[model samples]
Target: MKLGTLVKPLLITGLIIAGPAMAAPSAQQVLAASPVDDIVERYPAMMSEGIREGLKRSPQLPPMVADTIGYVVSNSFRAADIEQQIVKNLERDLSGKQLEAVEGWYKTPVARKISAVEIAASDPAAWQQMQAKAAELGKKYKGTDRARMFERFDRAARATESAVDTTIAVQLGLATAMAAFSPDSANYDELKRKIENQRNAIRGVVEQQVYDSYLHTYEKISMQEMGLYIDFLESGPGSAFSKTVTQSIQQAITDPIESIGNQMARFLAPQK
Candidate 1:
């Protein structure tokens, strides 16, 4: 899941034991202990909301076509499916030590506190609040040490990078949804190139948005607490977990997107 969710971004579950010893924690166990599960559960709605807004700002399509795109996207991006993918990837990609480290870290008081704030920030409602208080946040933390710390946290979390990846995914989904309508013009490779070209511009907007989100999300969190969280994220295990989740989400999101055009085409086809 992306934090600060689709407008922003998103855990773990279960264990087996034998005799007196706990079995090596499965990916499911790690996930149950992590924030990914809760945060990811909110993704379908966040993504739908984000894309709906994006579509509104885009060149106008007929209401029926727009609705079709929304429906296709909504169905294609399922939270359960994404969570399952993350769990599977975690089991396959992360070593036993890495998994144990992640699970342990997430169960920490500091990690829990940070996770709670992050989960809260993933709500679409939170995005609304962030916008409403944007000015207040900017005035209060614009140049302070806390603001700088938030910047460090953002980098540590790769929040801007995740947001950028999400933006590109959404754009690619849009192009895919419209491809059937203009296959000749909607060359996927060409569209991908165009999206790549806008990377720097996208980064500028996303970086500020991510920073603002950090300010808003961590408003109650102390600078010291933020510093500790940043340090963990920069640590080996924490970095591994962050990358794992990021890659998992990217794959889950992009995998479905590839075939969405065909789905949209079928959905928009005339009833026989």
Candidate 2:
């Protein structure tokens, strides 16, 4: 999906993961309080540069994006703890696919992709093209308040894409860390399978939590959007069209998350 489309949904998802307070501290505070400081302290040479780079990039982000980065950093630290749990509980080393899966989680692929898009969006020509396309879509769906709906959809799509990327990064990162620290001496394939199993289990839980949080946030946003749409419809000339477009946008916003939950459930199912 287009990057603009995913922004809102991704932001909504990030907000959900961040919880009600959503009170992530500034980059400075995060640097001080982050558990990764332990890792950095231990492997100063290996990690300090990367941490600094991440921090440098952190300030370039929009406030919402910066908060999401904090969430990612916090989650990465938590993944380390979970890795220790896996080592203790499973009594086996992580390998291959399993390793990849865990490492995927913290890598922030979604954010990276959005970063690229934001760059593209910055170019005047590219920005104009996007607006032109949006206008065309608006015209095509005329009389249905399609213009505003199109904008929301474009934003939501970008957000969803980013969220999915972030999800993958977190999974992969967790898997990699688990493998590095695991004590068992199983072969790569066996280790990998076990790691994948564990990763899948952990991801299933994370996905469910994220999904629930997203639904709650979506409900609130949808209600506000609907209320505003109704007000426009009542006072303005586009009431019926506005309602139809709003409903359609809500469905588009929800369908992907629902599908993602279903897909995750399949992976999470009990192995008989």
The alpha-carbon RMSD values of the candidates against the true structure, listed in the order shown, are 12.0, 25.6
**lDDT, candidate 1, 1-272, per-residue tens:** 55544432111112222422554578999988988899999888877777777766656467656765676677778898998988888888888888888888888898899889989999888888998898899898878998778667777788888989988878887766555556365567777888889999989998889878888898998888888888888988788778888889888887776577556655654455
lDDT of 2 by residue, 1-272 (tens): 99978898999888898764444223222223222223323321222233333434533334453344334343333323332332332222322333233223213453233223433443334434554454444345455543344334434333343333344433333333233333552443454465456655655554443333233223223444543433433532232222322333333222233233233333333445
Candidate 1: segments with Cα more than 4 A from true spot: 1-22, 179-184, 265-272
Candidate 2 — worst ten consecutive residues by lDDT sum?
27-36
TM-scores for every candidate against the unseen true structure: 0.84, 0.22
Candidate 1 has its poorest 10 consecutive residues by lDDT at: 8-17
Sequence-dependent TM-score of model 2: 0.22
Cα deviation of 94, candidate 2, in Å: 39
